[model samples]
Target: MLEVLNNDWKRLLEEKMYLCVSIALTICSIVAAIVLTNTMQTKGNIAMVVTDQSANTSLSKKFSSSPYFHVSKMKKAPLESDMVQNRYDAIVTMKEDGSYNIKTIKSDDMKKMIVGALNNPDSYVPSNDKDREIGTNIMGYMMMFVLIQGLFYARFFAKDKEEHIIKRVVTSPIAFRKYLFGHATFILGMIFAPTFAVILIAKILGVAIGFSLLTYALLIAVLSILATAFALFLNSFFCVADTANMIGTATITLTTILAGSFYSFTKKESVLDKLVHLLPQKDFINYVNALEKGHLSRNIELQFIYVLVISAIFFLIAVMKTKRDYVYR
Candidate 1:
C-alpha cells in the first residue's frame, strides 16, 4: 500500500492534476463567494414601499425595525408594475383595519420571511449571520468542486486499465486491494487539497466560515472520502479514460443540479424534494446550514453516519467491481 501510494503520488505530480484543479477551483470559489454575497444582500433585504401613513405608526415602525426589510414611506400609490420590474422587492399597503397587503416578486422563502416580520416585528431579529452565509456559499461551491474533480481523478483508474498497468500490478506481489486502496487514498488527498485551499483563501479574503476549524476539517475529510468513493464507483463502469470522463462528467452535472447545489427548490411537492434525500450533496449543504444555526451536535452525528454509510457502500461496490474486472483478469 505504501509503495502504491508513493507511485500514485508520483503519477499525480507528473500529471499536475491537483495543482491545476486546486488553483482553478480556488479562484472559482472566491468569485462565487463574492457573487453570492452581493446576490444574497439583494434577495435577503426585502425593500418595502409603504403608501399609507395613517394606518399605524407603531406597525410601520415595527416593519422598519425588522432586519429583513428596508421600509420607506411612499408619497404616491404603490404600483405592481414597478414591483414586477423588481424596482421594489415588495409593496405593503395599509388597510383601514391596520392590516397589511403584500405584493412581491420574491420566492416562497423570501415571501415567508416578509410575512413573518410583519406578524411580529418586535420579536423579529434580522439575521446578521455572516459566518453562516459565507459558510454555505463556500460549502456549496466546494461540494460542486469536489464532484467535478472526482470526475477528472477517476480518469487515473481508466487510464491505468487502458495502459495495462492494472494487468502488470496483478502479476506482481502487491495485493490488488492494497492497490485500489492506495488509489482511493490518493483521490481523497487530491480532493481535500482544494477544500483546504478554499478555506484558507476564504479566511484570507475575510469571509467568515461560521464553524470552528476542527469542525470544518472533519466535514471536509468526510466529504472528500465520499467524493473519492463516488468517483471510484463511477469509474468502475468504464475501462476507457475518455468514456469515463464523458459519462461521469455528465452524470455528476445533472445530479448536482437536481440535488440543489446551485438553485434551491422551494416548493414542497416538487420532484426534487423526493429525489434530494438520495443525494449526498443535499445532506452536505443541509449540514452546513445546520452548523450555521449552532445545531451541530445532532447534525454532526447524522451527517457523519449518513456520509460514512454511503461512502462505505459505494467503496465496497467499487472494490467488488475491481475484483471482478481487474483482479480475476
Candidate 2:
C-alpha cells in the first residue's frame, strides 16, 4: 500500500491537469455560490405598472417602501411580456377607482411575502433563503464531483487491466493485497484532495459552509473511501475501459439521483424515501448539514458506518473477482 501511494504521489506531482481542473472547479463553485447568495439576499423584485395616468396613490408608495420589493413602474401593456421574460416577480396595475389588479410570475412564497409586507409594513422582515440555497447547491455538486471521480477511477482500473499492468504487478515481488490496498488509497486521496480544496476555497471566498473545516475534511474522507470502493467494484465486471466507464457512469448517476443529491426525496413517507436511506450520499449530505448546525446525531454515525460497510463489501468483492480472474501463479 505504501509503495503504491508513493508511486501515485510522484505521478500526481508530474501531472498537473488534475490540479488545474480542481482549482478551476473550486473557483467556479465559490463564484456561483456568491452569485446565488446575493440573489437570495435580494429576494424577488415586484414591478408595479400603473395603467391610469392619475392612479398614482399610497398603494404604490407602500409597495416601494416595503422591504420585500424593489418596485419599478412601467406601462401596464407590457406586463405579460415582462413576466414571461422573468423581468419582474409580479406586476400591480392601479385602476382609477383606487382598485388594483396584480399579476405575478413569482412563487407562492414570494407572493405571500408581498401580501404580508403590504398588510403590515413594520412587521415584514426580508427573507433570507441563502442558507438553504447554498446548502443544496454545495451538497448536489459535491456528490456529483465524487461520483464522477469514481467513474474516472473505474477508467483507470480498466486501463491497467487492458494494458496487463495489473497482472504484471501481481506477479511482482509486491503482494497483491498490498497493491490493491495501495491502489484504493491512491484513488481515495485523489478524490479527497479535490473535494477538500473546493470546500476550503469556498470558505475563503466568504461562502458559508455549515460545518467546520475539520468536520468537512472528515466527511470528505469517508465519501472518498465509498467512491473508490464502488469504482473498483464496478471495474471488476469489465475488462475494457469504455465498457467500465459506461456502466460506472450509469450506475453512479442512478444512485446519485436516488440519494437525493439533486433534491430531497425524504419529505414524504414512501418506499423510495425509506429505501434511499441505504444510499451513502443522502446520508452523508444530511450528516454534513447536521454537523454544520454544530450537532452530531446518531444518524451521522449510522451514515459513516453504512459507507464504511458498503465500501468494504464492494472492495472485497472486487478483490476476490480480481484474484479469481486476473492474478495467476
Candidate 3:
C-alpha cells in the first residue's frame, strides 16, 4: 500500500501546474473568509419596508448607519424566497411610531441584533460568537472547489485505465486493492491538507472559528474522505476522464448548493425535505450548524453517522465496480 501510494504521489507531482492552481484556489478562499470576518462592520442584512411613498427616510438611514446592519430601503416587502436564499437576513416593516415587525429564519442571536438596533440604534455589539460558525462559513465556501479538485485528481486513475496501465497493474503481483487505496489516499490528502492547514493556522492566530480546533479538524477530515470517495464513484462509472469529470462537476455543484453549503434554509413541505435529506452534504452542514450551538444532540450524531455511512457506501460501490468491470472482465 505504501509503495503504491508513493508511486501515485510521484505521478501527481509531475503535474506542477495543477497543484499550484489547486493550492492557490483553496488557500485564497480561506484567507478571504478570515479577511472578511475581521473587516466586516455589518453583522446582518435587513430589508426595511416603508408603506408610504412620502415616508421619512431617516429611519432607514438610521439602521443603515448602525454597525450591526446593512439596511436596504424597499418600497415593498422582500419576498419569502429572498429570505430563504439569505439575500436578506431579516425583513422589517417599520411603523411611524419607531416600532418595527421583523421576520427571519436566523437564530435568536440575529433577532437580538435587530431588536437592539430598533431600541437604541446604537446599542448592539456583534457577539464574539457570530450568528453562524465561521468554521461552517469556511466549509460553505471551500467545499465545492475541494470536491471538484478530487474529481480532477482522480483523472490520474482514469488516465491509467485509458493508457492500459491499470490493466497491467491488475494482472501484476501488486494487489488491485492496494493500487486503488493508493489513488484514494492521494486524492484525499490533496483535497484535505491545504484546506485544513488554513483553518488550523487561523485558529492559532486567534480567529474566532466558532468551534474547537479538534472539531474543525474532524469536519475537514470527513469532508475530504467523502470528496475522495465521491470522485472515485463517479470515475468508476465512466472510464473516460472527460465524461466522468463533466458529470461529476455538475453533480457536485448542484448538490452542494441544494445542501445549503452557503445558506441554510428550511423547507416547508415533506417532499422537498425528503429530497434534500438524500444529499450527503445536507447532513454534513447540519452537523456543522449543530456544533455551533455547543452541544451534542442525537440529531447531530445522526447527521455525522449519515455522512460517514454515505462516504463508506460510495467507496464500497466503487470497489465492486472495479472488480466487476476492470479486473474480472
Candidate 4:
C-alpha cells in the first residue's frame, strides 16, 4: 500500500492536469471568499432615507456612532419607485405617532444592523428577523460552494476509470486496496492545501473565517475521502466512461441539492430533510454552523468520525465489487 501510494503520489505530481486543477480551484476559492467578504462588509454600511427630516438628526447621530451601522441621510421621503431604483440599503419613514417604518431594499445586513440599533433593550425598538434570516441564507450559499466543489472532484474518479488508467493500475503489482487508498490520499491532501489557502486569504482580508483549524482540517479531510470513495463506487458499477460520468454528475448534483447546496433545505420541514441529514455534506454544514455559533462540541467530533467511517464502508464495498468483477472476467 505504501509503495502504491508513493507511486500514485509521484504520478499525480507529474500530471499537469492535477496541478492545473488544484491551482484553478485555489484561485476560485480565493475569489469567492473575497467577493463574499466584500458583499458582507458593504452590507454593513446602512443608507437610510428619512421621511421626516426632523427624525433624521437623532437617528443619524445614533446610527453613525454604531460600528455596525453607517448612517446616510436622503434629501426627501423616498418613493417606493425610488427605493427600488436607488442603491440605498434601507428606507426609514417616521409616522405621526413617532414610530418608524423601515424598508430594506438592498442588503439585509444593513437592515439588521439598523433594526438592532433601533431596538436595543436600552431603547424601545422592534427586532427584525428578516435580516437575520438573510444572513443565514448568505451562509447557506457558502456551504453550497463546498458541496459543488466536492461533486466536481468526485467526477474525476469516474474519468480516470473511463480512461482505462484505473484498470491498468489494477493489473499492476499494486493491490487494489492500495490503489484506492492512494487515490483517496491524493484527493484528501489536495483538498486541504487549497482549503487552508482560502482560509488564510480570508483571514488576511479581515473576514471572520471563524472555525478552528483542526476541526476544519478534519472536516475537509473526511469530505475529500467520502467524495473519492463514492466516485470509485460509481466507477466500479458503471461499464462505460460516459455512463459513469453521467451517473457521477447526477449523483453529486442530486446529493448537493438535497444537502441544501443552493438553499437551506431545513427551511422546509419534510422527509427530504430527514433523508438529507444522512449525507456527509449535511453533517459538515451542521458542524460549520455550530462553529460559527461558537458551540463546538464532542458531537461535531463524532460527526467527523462518522464521515470517515462512511467513506471506509463505501470504499470497502467498491473494492469487493471490483475484485469480484476482475476475478470472474
C-alpha root-mean-square deviation, each candidate: 5.6, 5.9, 3.8, 7.1
Model 3, span 1-329: residue lDDT tens: 77777877788789777778777877777776656656777777988887674247566567767876788887899788897778999998887766679999765567777887777765656665544556677776777788888886899988887788888898888899988998999899887887777778878888777667787778888988999999898888887889999999999999998777775554445466678978989888777877776766997889889989999999999989987987888
Error of 4 at 224 (Å): 1.7
Estimated TM-score for each candidate: 0.73, 0.67, 0.80, 0.60
User: Quick one: how many clashes does candidate 1 have?
Assistant: 0
Candidate 2 lDDT, tens digit per residue, 176-283? 898888878778878888778878877887768756788677777877888888888888878887888787778778888767675452433566677888787777
Q: Pick the candidate with the highest lDDT.
A: 3
Best by TM-score: 3
Off by over 4 Å in 2: 6-19, 41-137, 204-207
Backbone N/Cα/C clashes per model? 0, 1, 0, 1
Which candidate do you rate higher for lDDT, 2 or 4?
A: 2
Model 3: lDDT equals 0.80
Lowest lDDT block of 10, candidate 2: 127-136
Q: Which residue pairs show collisions in model 1?
A: none
RMSD in Å for model 1: 5.6
lDDT of 4: 0.58
Worst 10 residues of 4 by lDDT: 129-138
Q: Candidate 2 or 4, higher TM-score?
A: 2
Question: lDDT values of the candidates?
Answer: 0.71, 0.70, 0.80, 0.58
**What is the C-alpha lDDT profile of model 1 across 198-283, one tens digit per residue?**
77666677766655667777778888888888889877877788887778778777777666565564345556575675777777
